[model samples]
Target: MNDIAAIPVWAIIPVSLLLIVGGSIVLIGALGLLRLPSFYQRIHGPAITVTLGAGCLLIASMIYFTVLQSRPVIHEIIISLFLLLTAPIVAMMIMRAAVYRDLRAGKKDAGAAAGGIYQFPEESE
Candidate 1:
């Protein structure tokens, strides 16, 4: 097997910390998705997972590869960028669909208006 570069202890410490923290955040986000009461609230859980968790993981990957190879290993940024951009759109669509479905079912909730249409009061002249 080819010899890998001996990573410095100092570098390893921070990288390890990053990996642990990111993994924990990802786990918490997953827990929130399972525990949250509403669909809208749950929509935000994976955003946190992708943004903080995936972002740190990619950074860790980039750092480790670059250090071992003695070159810029920034290809991991593509995954990070894709997650950051796509997570929000997917979350929003899920939330919107949930709202539409609930409205269609006509469940009476405080925020949900009649016929899913809000009636704004007229301002006095």
Candidate 2:
């Protein structure tokens, strides 16, 4: 758009930075999900890291649209509010469910290495 083209390079730099940072945060979170050893540890990926990533992305989008359109682009606030409200709740629910399942299966506090993950030592032959 003409308005976007007219925006200053300073604005563009911040927008691009925010987008890249947000994307990197999301990627790191996804990688954490893949690399963490247990359900509890993995849950932190989307709950904290992804939420932060989405916040950064949303902020960048807001700034870009606001400056580009020469108006206050505020719908992103609603989305951010929803995300803030739901992320922790969802994380807590996931944790509760996982904890319940572990307890039901008699694995509560079974190990100490992050989310009750056990590293069993092999016996010498």
Task: Return the top candidate by TM-score.
Answer: 2
Global lDDT of each candidate = 0.75, 0.82
Highest lDDT model number = 2
List the candidates' TM-scores in order.
Answer: 0.79, 0.81
**Which pairs, if any, clash in model 1?**
none
Local distance difference test, candidate 1: 0.75
lDDT of 1 at 73: 89
List where candidate 1 sits over 4 angstroms from the true fold. 1-5, 110-125
In angstroms, the error of model 2 at 41 is 1.0
